[model samples]
Structure formats: C-alpha cells, structure tokens
Target: MSEEPLEQLDAVDFAVIAFHVDGEWDVDELTLDHLLDAPTLVAAMRRLPGEDSVALVAVDEDWFLVARVVEGRVRMLLSDATAAEDWDLAASVLDLLGLPEPEDDDDQVPAGDLGLLADLGMGAEDLGALIADLDLYPEEILSEVAEEIGFGDDFDDVVGLAPADHA
Candidate 1:
C-alpha cells in the first residue's frame, strides 16, 4: 500500500482533547500554527481545573499522544515511533519527551515510553499493535482507545466521528 505524508492529515484530522472524565472534555482542532510543544501542551492541560486531567492527541492515522498530569507531576506517552520525522506535532512530542529524531526512516516502532498508561488499559504494546492494523482509520483507533479508557462515546461525539462509520 502506498502512504500519504502525515503532514497532509494535519489539516482537518489532527485533534487534541483535555479531559477530566468526571468533569469536562475540551477539544482542540490542531493546526500547524498551534502545534505547541510538550511543555506548552501540558501547561495548558494543567489549567483545566481537575485533579485527573489528561490530554489525548491524535494526528491522523499515524500518531497518538497521551499526557496525564496529577498533583503537579506529568506522565505521557507518544506513539507511532516513526512519525517524529514526518509530522511537526510528532517532532514536538519528541522534544517534550526529550527523545532524539529517528536515525532511520522505517517509521514502524513506538518512539517514546509506551508503558506510560499501562494501568489505564492501553499500554505501549497494545497501542503499537493497534497502529499496525492498517484497516482502521485514526478515528476508529482513537474511538477504541477512548472506549478502553472509559470515554468511547464522548470522544466520538467531540471529534464528530460517526459511530456508524467506525462500527
């Protein structure tokens, strides 16, 4: 199968959510100008006024970033090991995680700490395996991941992804 550059997906496909499961989940449609680096993203998430705030970001069908902040501490995971070289948001994620760009262009590995949310249901390996499933679009995969973590319908609604399509 031929692949389109992930940069193209950033147009309408990139989105981020700052959520507190019991409270609110705010969505942001990411554009090239607002592709904030990790620290900035986390700081914004911090202002969400919840003890259990998490930032979930998906860039097309190629990458996902999950960041959680608790008691002033931050934990995060940036998936799609290969997107760092192709997507600006992914590269910014690498900077936030303090990881270097990939030396090779295979784009098939999990770049940052995958185990970051292992206890929350979707671990690194699970995410890696999900990404390998080329049959699913980013919305479908994100829907599954969100459901695993207890926000299936909310995420789909916020992202405007029809349940019928993913089903």
Candidate 2:
C-alpha cells in the first residue's frame, strides 16, 4: 500500500441511490461526507423506504462500487480489489465481505459479490465482464449497469450524463 493516507486518496465522482417503485425506477443523487465509508453508505441505503435499494458509486474515475440492501441484508461489489489499498470505502467493503486487504502486487481484480445485482437483471457474469473491460471508465461501467437494471435514463439524468441517442 502507498504511504498516503486514505483521506488523500478517496475521491468520489458521484453517488446515486436507486430503487424500484410502482413498476418504475427512482434514481436520486446521494451526498455523503464519507463517501468511501461502507457502513455509512450501507446505512443510507437501508434507510430508504423500499424493500430493496441500491447505491452506485464511482470513485476517482478509477473504480466503482455497487451496494445493495435487500430485506436488511447488504451486498456489495468493488470493481478493483487493489483499490482497497488507497480507499477506505474499498477497504471497508473487503472487511464487510471478510476478504483480506489486497497486497501491493495483487491483481487489479474485482472483490465482493458480483451477483449483488443478479435479481435486477445484471447477473454476475455480465457484471464481471463489464468490470474487466479496462477500456471503460468507472462511470461508464456504472452507466452500463444502470442500463441493464432498468434505470439508465434516470441515472444519466441524476449524474448529468448526456442521454444516449435513441434515433
């Protein structure tokens, strides 16, 4: 791990809270003082008025996190396991999942449950492949995920991403 503290490395590009209601998806931006804190993020997700809620976060354009709370159970996915070294959110996620902190030379792979969004149409295989694609930025990967889970437009609107051309 680098000598720099997590406070210096943690940079959240955006955080979005999403949930399904009345057959439609509701997406809203979330502002957190400690965006990299897994407990804080999960607690916020759990407080939403829904049976299930999801938080999609992009950090420093280098990694992404998907946290889902279902019936009081929490599931999370971190795009790059190695990010744990530099970000408290990633480290805390590994801690929550009972994963060891990644070593300096560890492969930059994903950690946590890829199936966290399985029931929402983004299965483990699809998510794994998406994160593995190094060509995409964290926000792009999350945008694709939102599309798969039926909230692409809502996510784009909340995050100020230009709408995709439908024509």
Superposed Cα deviation of residue 95, candidate 1 (Å): 1.7
Model 2, span 74-97: residue lDDT tens: 999999988888777788899898
Model 2 stretches with alpha carbons more than 4 Å out = 1-10, 34-36, 104-106, 165-167
Cα deviation in Å at residue 7, candidate 1? Answer: 8.4
Top candidate when judged by lDDT against the true structure? 2
Q: Give the C-alpha lDDT of model 2.
A: 0.83
Q: What's the CA error at residue 140 for candidate 2, in Å? A: 0.7
Clashing pairs in 1: 81-111
Best by TM-score: 2
Global lDDT of each candidate = 0.65, 0.83
Off by over 4 Å in 1: 1-12, 21-34, 164-167
TM-score, model 1 to reference: 0.75
